[model samples]
Target: PTTTQAGRAKPNILVTGTPGTGKTTTSSLLAEATQLRHINVGDLVKEKGLHDGWDEELQCHILNEDLVCDELEDMMEEGGNIVDYHGCDFFPERWFDCVVVLQTDNSILYDRLSSRGYTGSKLTNNIECEIFQVLLEEAKASYREDIVMALQSDSLDDISRNLSTLTGWVNNWILDRSS
Candidate 1:
């Protein structure tokens, strides 16, 4: 959707990926550099009690998608938000101007998840999710292909490069909206 339709001067971006793929770090830094609000959906779910219940197998909250969407609707309509989440299919497509799916190499992702104490089915499922590009595909299916991008997130350099690319995009978005 166009910024004009939302009456927004800035854009809303969704940064998503498999767990340990740097969605939080990238979105946090991007928000700091671009002055956009960073909404970590996981954190939001916990903070707002917007969940059905805990998922015993997943070791995470069973997010109440409707509640989460309702909570975010107004801010999203106003734009200038960098939403960090692992899954994308549940979010409303119109909430974002750009969708970034960060990908990390399988081995690196394994190590990262391992260090984070992820084990058994949780770790195995996440690794498989990355290997299969689940999140990237979900984003593409959920949003316009032109607005969805997959960026590397295996190292600090990659994160820096992504930040630069996204910062430039943000500038262009503003210019395009203004003109």
Candidate 2:
């Protein structure tokens, strides 16, 4: 059953992109504006030990996808979740009403990643991911095309625009649910 069918008044949104693309910032702001719950998957993975182990080369955790899904299943069903993560393919397609894949220019992304101390293969791999639009492809593959969108996050203005756009979408969703 859908969240609406389950009597949930709000929708679940997935905010995904390569590192430094502002998934957390966007999700947090969106959640604040809409009074939705923001679940930063990276932080949840770390805090809840929802991963097999850390990948030293990647300088990140090896996410246990099944565990992540299991942990989020209930909340997702109840709706009103803003899930922020880099990877998207592993999540259940039914979990999100909207899947937003944030895209950033290579040079801008490079600077952001570099400032975050991302170097060597970790940095290169992420830059290449953005260059190739890997996350957008993953989201499209994992969800219905109509529900997935790629949004720019190259500058503060872009983020502001995205926030406004998504907030309006949320309002429309609520109205749709009511009707």
Candidate 3:
């Protein structure tokens, strides 16, 4: 989609939530349907070696927030990128036209995480984070309330509904900006 303002031809969408909340899944479908580039932050961190070092305990890399933003700033400004990550506060608030935080029921989340082999502290921390709606609250705090929304990802039906609703919204945004 093209924007009225030159050099702003696309919209940046951030799809974020606690782990196992389906941010990647939703963003993937959205990208396919909307023709946006899907950038999984985790994959980016790994590919670009943007991480500081490995976290043996958490079993994940320690990402450098500054480096990540620097590396992605250009694409973000050019727009039409759907960013999928569990955390959002570190990203510049202005980078996104919309921030979607997917939510899942605790039991459903537990099952999903368990199936992924998340155990003990890691699993518990993630579940607690979901229960507390940390990602949703963070999105709201980082961006205008109108631009940040909490979407349910509890089932396939919910995912379908979300995709339809969000695709419509994206279309409207493009039309509005272009006009």
Best by TM-score: 1
Residue runs of model 3 more than 4 Å from their true location after superposition: 1-7
Q: Please provide, for model 2 over 11-101, each residue's C-alpha lDDT reduced to its tens digit, 9 standing for 90 to 100.
A: 8999999999999999999998999999999999999999999888777899999999999989988889999999998887777889999
For model 1, residues 1-179, the per-residue Cα lDDT tens digits are: 54453588899999999999999999999998999999999999999999999999999999999999999998998888999999999988777889999999999999999999999999999999999999999999999999999999999999999999999999899889897
Instruction: Score each candidate by Cα lDDT.
Output: 0.93, 0.91, 0.91
Stretches of candidate 1 exceeding 4 Å from the true structure: 1-6
RMSD of 3: 2.7
Of 2 and 3, the candidate ahead on TM-score is 2
Instruction: Using lDDT, give the best candidate's number.
Output: 1
Q: Looking at candidate 1, what is the lDDT of residue 46? A: 97
Better of 1 and 3 by lDDT: 1
Superposed model 2: Cα runs more than 4 Å off? 1-7
